[model samples]
Target: MAINRILIANRGEIALRIHRAAHEMGIETVAVHSTADADAMHVRLADHAVCIGPPAAAESYLNHAAIISAAEVAGCDAIHPGYGFLSENARFAEKVEAHDIAWIGPKPEHIVTMGDKVQAKKTAGELGLPLVPGSDGAVSDPEEGRKIASEIGYPVIIKAASGGGGRGMKVCESEDKIESLMSQAGSEAKAAFGDATVYIEKYLGNPRHIEFQVFGDGNGNAIHLGERDCSLQRRHQKVLEEAPSPVISDEERERMGEVCAQAMRDMGYRGAGTIEFLWEDGEFYFIEMNTRLQVEHPVTEAITGVDLVREQIRIADGKPLSVAQKDLEFRGHAIECRINAEDPFTFAPSPGKVTYYHPAGGMHVRVDSGLYAGYSIPPYYDSMIAKLIVYGRDREGCIMRLRRALEEMVVEGVKTNIPLHRELLHQKDVLHGDYSIKWLEEWLESRED
Candidate 1:
C-alpha cells in the first residue's frame, strides 16, 4: 500500500526533517504536536497539524493512543516516529501496525530483540559479530557477578539490560567493587526503565565509538552506508559525529560493512538501523544496535549521498532499496555538531524566546533547526536546538569549512553550545582526530580546573 500521507509523531528538527522528505517524495504530512509546539516550524510547514496533549512528553508524544487517534483523525495512512520518543518502542510499532498504519521503521520483533542489551549482545554473537567478553546473561547473584568479573579481568562494566544514556551503568576496576556496583546499577535500572535486570561487560579503557548505518528492504537485501565516529561525547551523550572515521581504512570499511549488511540480510530486517561498536587497537567489539533512525544520521547521509528518510518510506511501502552495495560510494567527509540550548561552559538548560536567530549557510553546509526569532523553546523536551552539518572533499577540508560555519552561526536571547563547539574545533586532539570516548570528558574536566 502506498503511503499518501504520513503523520510525523514527533516534534523539533526531526519532525521537520520527515516533513521535508515526505513532501519531496510528493506525499503530504500531518504534524502531531503538543500544545507547547503549536508554533513549531514543522507544524507550520506541514500540510495539516493536530494538538495532541500538553507539554509533558508522557501525556503527548509517548501517549500512543493519542498519537494513533491523531493520525486517524488527520487521515494519515502512515506514521513516522523520528528518533527518540516512541521510535524504538516495539509494542508501539505493533500497535501502529495493528491499527493498519505503515510504520516507517524496523520490524517490531527486531526492535524487541535489539532493544534489550543482553539479548542484543547474544544476537550479535550469533551473527558472527565480535562481542566484549562478559556474563552470558543477567547477573542476579553477587557471587556469580564476582566470578564473571574475575574471569573477565578487572575493570568490568555493569549496565542495565534496557537502559541507555549512561543512566544505569557503573565501571568497576576491581573485583571488590563488583557487588556494590551491580546493586547500584540494578537500582538505577529499576528507577529509570522499570526493569532491574543488569548485565556485565568487559570495560573498554579507551575505545572510539564507531557505528555503521544500515538499511534493509524487509526481504533479504540489506546494505551498509559506512561508519560514523561518535567518540566526542560528554556524560555518554554525543556532542558531535563524523562519517568515515579517520582510523578505519577503505579495506576495513568494506570488510566490516559487508559483515554488518550480511547480518541484517540474514535477519530479514527492515528500515534504518545502526550497529554501534567500540574500536581499540584495530579490533571492533559490538556494544549495541539502535533499531531506529539515529540523531546523527545526517552525517552518514552527507557522506553517502543517500536520502535515508526517503529510503525508509520506500522500504516501509514494500519497495526494494534504491541503491545496492556496489553502487553506493563514499565521496567526502562530513561532520555534525549538535547545537544545544544550554550554557556552553556549565551545560545548563537555557530555554527561552529567541530574540534573533541566524543559521550558517554555504556550500556543503546544512543546518537542521526549528528556531525562529519570536519562537520560545519549551523546557519540557530535549535541549538540542539545531544540527549543523558540513561536508568537504577531505577531513581537513571538512574541519576548515566547519570552523568557518561555526563563526557564521548566531543564536541570541538564550545561551547555546556554539561556543563549546568552537573551542572543541581548536583542540589539538580533535584536529588530529586522535581522541577516544573519554577524551571530551577529560578535556572538559581540565577546562574546569
Candidate 2:
C-alpha cells in the first residue's frame, strides 16, 4: 500500500513543501499547475509537472476532472491537496478514491461531517467534546435565529455551515440587528459556499484561539500533538501561530489533548487533522475541525520534530502511526508568521514579479517559500508568499529569534506584510503573549489613528 508517486493538486509553498517531503521519503512528485503558474517553484522542483488549465482556479485548481486526468496521465498513485482550493472538499476526496487513487487526507465522510459547522458541533458533542451554546442545526428563518440568540445571550455569531477562512460570518450584538445580520450571513454563505444555510453560535468575547493537532491511522487509533496558540488573527484568519500555547497549563494541555485524541478515535478519523477550540475562562469550546493539513503545520513540526507530510503519505498508505501517544513528546517552543504578497497597510494584494528574494537562515530558523528571485507571483490565488518559522528553547527565545529572522529576510518588487509583522512582534501584548482572536484586529485599527 506504499505510495511511490504522488500528484500535488496545488501550487505555491505548500506544493513545494509536499514535494520536498516526498523526495526525502524516496517518493516521486508530480506538480499540477495553472497556466499562470508555469514557472512556479513547486512545478520546477517536482519530478514532473502538468498544466491543468488556464489562469482561473475554477477551470484549473478546482476542476477535479482535469486534476484526475493529470494524475492518471502522470501515473501517480496519490493526490495531495494542500490547504485551500480543494483541500477540504469531500466530493473531491470521494472522487479520488473512486479513481483508485489515494487521497492523502481524512475520509470523505469525515470531511463532510466536519466541513459543516452545525454537523461538526453535533459530532463533537457526540464525542463528548464541549460546544458553544447555540442552535443545533441551520437556522432557516430570521425568527429562529433571533430565538436562538435570545437563549444564547447577546453577541451571537452567525456562521455558514460550510464556511472557513473568515467568510460568511457575522456578529450580531442585539435582537434588533439579528434579522439583517442573518440575511447577510446567508447571502454571503450562498455566494461563497453555494449554500445559503447559516447557523447561530454564542460568541465568546476576547477568547483565545487554540487548536490541537491529531493524527489517526484509520483503524480508530490516534494521538494528539499538543496544542498551538493562533490568537493573533485578522478577520478570523490566523496571522501568526505558536506551539505550546503560552496560556495553557501543563495539566490543561494533557486534559485537552486526551479529549481530542479520544474524539478522533470515536469518529474513526484518518490522516492528519486539526481540532480547533475557543479557550475562555479556563474552559474550552469546540470550534470547527479542519479535515486536512493546516497552513500553520510547520510550527507543530518544529516543536514535535515530526514531518507531517511524510506521516500523511504513510497514513494514506494504510500504515500505522510511527509513534504512540506515550512515545510522543513536545520539545521547545516555535512560532510562524505568514508572509503575504499584499499592501502592508491596506492589506490589498500586491502580486507581481519578485525582483529580489532573500530568505533568512540560521539554527532553528526555517523558511518555506515557493517564490524565488525573478519569479512572478500570479494574482490569481491566495496572497501568502511564504511562511517564516523559528524555534527556540522557550517562548521568549522563540520570539526573539523570530524577530531577528524576520529582520534578516528581504523581498522586493512586491509589497509585503513584513512591516505589519515587525510591528506585531514589538507590540507589548504580543511580546507578553497576552492576546486573543479579537486583539489583532483591534490593534490594527489602533494603528490607523
Candidate 3:
C-alpha cells in the first residue's frame, strides 16, 4: 500500500492526531489551515501546510473545493478528513474520489446511508438488527408522526431525519405535545438540515449511550474493536468517554459487537464507522450510524493498540481485515475528558489567546492538543482545546489518574470545564458508573438548587 502522503482536511487536535500517526507510519502529511490558524500547532508541525481559506469554517474546512485544490497543489495522494467538517460528508467523499484521490474514510454510499438517520434505521431493520421502534422514513405531517408514535407506544422522540448531536430532537410524552413538538422539530430541522423531514421513535427513558467501533475494507469484511460508554453527556453532546462500558455485561457486549459487525457487512460498510445505541430495560436499540472516525476514537485505540487511521488506509487499498475476531484482545481501561475552552459552570464558549499552558503528563496519559502558549482560541471553531486521555489497569485506577491529570493541567488565561470534570469524577454516582445520559444536566441543576 503506497499510502505515502496525506492531506488532512481538518483543523485542531484531529488534524494533529492524523499527522502524528502518519509521521510514525512513514507517510508525509500536509496540514490545511484557515487564516486564523496560520500559527496553529498542527500547521507548525506538519511536513507541509497551506491556508485553505478564511477564519470561518463554512468557507474553509467545509469548502471541499479548496481542500481538494490544496491536495492537488501539494501533490498529496490522499485526503484524510480527520473527524468534523467534511469528515462524514458523502458529497465531499465523492468529490475527492472524483479527483482520483483516495478518501481516507468510508465510501460515499456508506456515508450517505449512515448519515441519514431514518434510512440507516430502515437498513438496519432489514438486516434483522434490533432497532428502536420508529418511523421507517421521514414523515411529512404531524398526523403521520402521531400515527407512528401511537404504534410505537407513547413518550416518543421527534428527531430530524438528517440531524445529529441533539440539534433537532424533541421528546414528546403525550399526543398534545406531539403537535407542538412536531412543528418545533420540523422548523428546527428545516433550519438545520434544510429538509423539514422529521421522524418519530419510542424514546427510551434513562438509557445508557454505547457504541461499537467497526472497521471494514471495500471488499466487505469487517470486525469490531469493542464498545465505548458515552453515557456521561450534556445536551446529547458527549462530555466524557470510556471504553468497555462498566455497566454492560460481557455477554451483552459480545452480542452488541457481533450484530454491529454483521450490520456493517450487510450494508457494504468500509473504512472506520461507529454504530450508536441506547440500551435500557435490558434491550439494545441501534439508533444511528456515523460513517467516519468518531471524536472519541482515541479511547478505543488506547485499549486495542490499533491505529485506526492506518487501518483506514489499508482497507481503502482493498486489503481485508488483518485481525480476526478471535485474534483481537482488549485490555485495560481508557477515559477521555474533553478539555474545552469554556466556563465550567455556565458551559459557554471562552475564546481567547492562551496566556500560559501546562498540560498533564505521566504514565498512560495522552494529551492530544492543538493549542500552545500565546495561541488564540478563535471564536469560529469548536471550543474544545484538548482531549486528555488516560489509560489504566481498570476504571478505578483510571479515575485516580484523571483526577491527578486534571490537577496538573493549568490553562491560565481562560476558564475551562476542569472544575466540572473534577466535581463529576468525585461524585458517588459517576464514580460507580451508574449515571445516565441526563446525569450531567440533572447533576448540574441539583448543584444549583
Candidate 4:
C-alpha cells in the first residue's frame, strides 16, 4: 500500500507541493504537464516528467485515458489530482480505480452525491445533518421554484445542481424576480454542468463560510480535522482563509465537527473531504461537500501538522489513519492569501513573462508558489500564482506575518493582488477579523477616496 511512486495529475504550485511532500517521504514523483508547462518548475522539480497533451485542459488535464496510460507506463502506484481539472470528476476517479491505481480522493459515489446540490442536501438530511430547507429535486418550472421559495421564505438562492466558482447562482429578493432569475440560473447551469436542472434553497442572512475538514479510512474510522474560516471572499470564491475559525466557540465547534464526521460516515464516504457549511445564528446549514483535497489545505496542515494528501493515498490503499481524533492537536492559527496574476484594480488576468519574482520567507512564513523568475503566466488556466501561508500563536500574530509577507513579496512585470492585500490588512474591520463576504468588493467601491 506504500505509494512509493506517484504521478501528479496536475500542474503549478499544487504539483510542486505534492512533489516536495513525496520526496520527504522518499517517494518518487512523476509530474504530468501540458505543452505550455513543459519547462515549468513542477516539471523540473519532479523525479520524472511527462507531457500529457496540448495546452488546453480537455486534451491534457481532463483526458482520463491519457493520464491513466501515462501512469501505467511510468509504473506509478498513485495519481494525485491536485485541486482543479479532474480532481472532482467522478468518472475520472472511477477510471483511475479501474486501472488499480490509487485515486487520492473520495470514492466516485461520494463525488456524484456531492456534485448534485439537490441530491447532496437530501443525503445530508437522511444522515441527520443540518440543511437549509429547500427543494428535494430540480425545479423544471419557474412556478414550482417560486412555490418552493415561498415555503422556505425569501431571499432564496437558485443554484445549479452541478455548479462551481459561484457561477450558476441567483438570489431572488421577491416573487417579481423569480422567473427571470430562474431562467438565468438554468441557462448558466446548462452551459456549465451540461445539466440545466436547477434547485432552490433558503439563503441565510449574512452567513459566514465555515467548513470542516474530515478524513475517512474507507472503513468505520472518520475524524474531523478542525474547521476553517473562509468568510473573506469575493463573488462566492474565497480570497483569504484561516484555521480555527475565530468566531466559533469550542462548544459550537465540537457540535458541528461531530455532525459533519457522522454525516460523512453515513454516506459511506472514503478518503479526504471537506464539508462546507453556512454558519449563522449559531446554526449550521450544509453548503456542499468538496470531494478532493481543498485549495486551502495548507492552513489545516499548518495547524495540525497532518499531510492530507499522504493520508488520502493511504486511505485509498485500504490503510488505517495514523492518528486518532483525540491524539491530534491544533496548537496555533494559520492564514492563507491567494495571490492571482491579475490587475489589482480591474481584477483581469495579466499574463506575461515574470520580470522578477521574490517569494516571502521567514519564520512561520510558508509560500506555495507556481511561478519562478521568467516563468510565463499563461491565460489557459486560473491566474492563481502563489499561496502565502503564515502561522503564529494567534490570529493577530498570523495577520502580522501576512502583513510582513505582503510587504516583502515582490513580483515585477506582473500586476498582483499584493497592493490590494496591503490595503485589506489596514482596514479596521479586517484587522479586527469582523468582515463579511462582500468586504472586499464593498471596500473597493468605497475607496472612491
Candidate 1 global TM-score: 0.99
* Candidate 4: tens digits of C-alpha lDDT, residues 104-171: 88889889988878888888788887888888888888889889989999999998888778878999
Candidate 4 ranges with C-alpha deviation above 4 Å: none
Cα-based lDDT for every prediction: 0.96, 0.93, 0.88, 0.87
State which candidate, 1 or 3, has the greater TM-score: 1
> lDDT tens string, model 1, 95-204?
99999999999999999999999999999999988899999999989999999999988889999999799999999998788889999999999999999999888999
Encode model 2's per-residue lDDT on 398-426: one tens digit a residue.
98999999999999999999999988999
Which 10 residues in a row give candidate 1 its minimum summed lDDT?
173-182
**Superior by lDDT: candidate 1 or candidate 4:** 1
TM-score result, candidate 3: 0.97
Sorting all predicted structures by lDDT, with the top scorer first, yields 1, 2, 3, 4
Model 4, global lDDT? 0.87
Question: What does candidate 3's lDDT look like per residue over 64-144, in tens digits?
Answer: 889999999999889999888999899999999899898899889878877888888888888767888888888778788
Clashing pairs in 2: none
Candidate 3 clashing pairs, residues 3+ apart or interchain: none
Q: After superposition, how far is residue 441 of candidate 1 from its true place, in Å?
A: 0.6
TM-score order of candidates, top first: 1, 2, 3, 4
